[model samples]
Target: MAGDSLFGIHGAALEVRAQRMGVLASNIANASTPGFKARDIDFKQALASLEGGQGGGIAAATKYRIPVQTSMDGNTVELSEEQTAFAENAIQYQSTLSFLNGRIGQITRALKGE
Candidate 1:
């Protein structure tokens, strides 16, 4: 019962989101580095595969990001693109956390007969 209640799709989603945040943060950090290519995870595909009995923990397949405008230094890390992706991922992470919190609250209330 403990395991049943603690682990679910939302839990998996949170883990994936955290991983994505790390990748995006890395891209942002390497924005000015020469020849650094921006990389990102395929969130939807990874999550779907994970939920479809992939027989593994939450993980995403990292892929290089294509730049709209090529730089002379061969750096593909676009500051604006990285920033946007970071913001979107952060929002998703927070949303998943809030959902998990609400689920916990519901369970607690039920246990207390409230």
Candidate 2:
């Protein structure tokens, strides 16, 4: 959190978004695997934990997703839902990255006395 002051919440946000992307990707990858239960990160909770200086980070915020429709094989992944979440997370990740990039640019310009 010490470094967070440099970029505000965007730094932690980027990390959470990246982790969420992986979780969503995993869900998408295991969509056909029987008994595979989809899991996702609670972005707010994860970010809060990080900013609050608490341990556990993403793992503590990770939660099993409840399926919109149960499958006979017990696989909880819904491909469409996972895909949509992934896309949205990807967009958010990009936005966070952009914010960080802009911040870095400002720092660079300031350092150069520009």
Note the Cα lDDT for every prediction shown: 0.82, 0.94
What C-alpha lDDT does candidate 2 achieve relative to the native structure? 0.94
lDDT of 2 by residue, 1-114 (tens): 767669988889999999999999999999999999999999999999998889999999999999989799999999999999999999999998998999999999999999
Error of 2 at 93 (Å): 0.4
TM-score of each: 0.85, 0.97
Clashes of each: 0, 0
Best by TM-score: 2
Pairs with backbone N, CA or C atoms under 3 Å apart (clashes), candidate 1: none
* Candidate 1 segments whose C-alpha is farther than 4 A from its true place: 1-7, 55-60
Worst 10 residues of 1 by lDDT: 53-62
The residue pairs in collision within model 2 are: none
Q: Give the TM-score of candidate 2.
A: 0.97
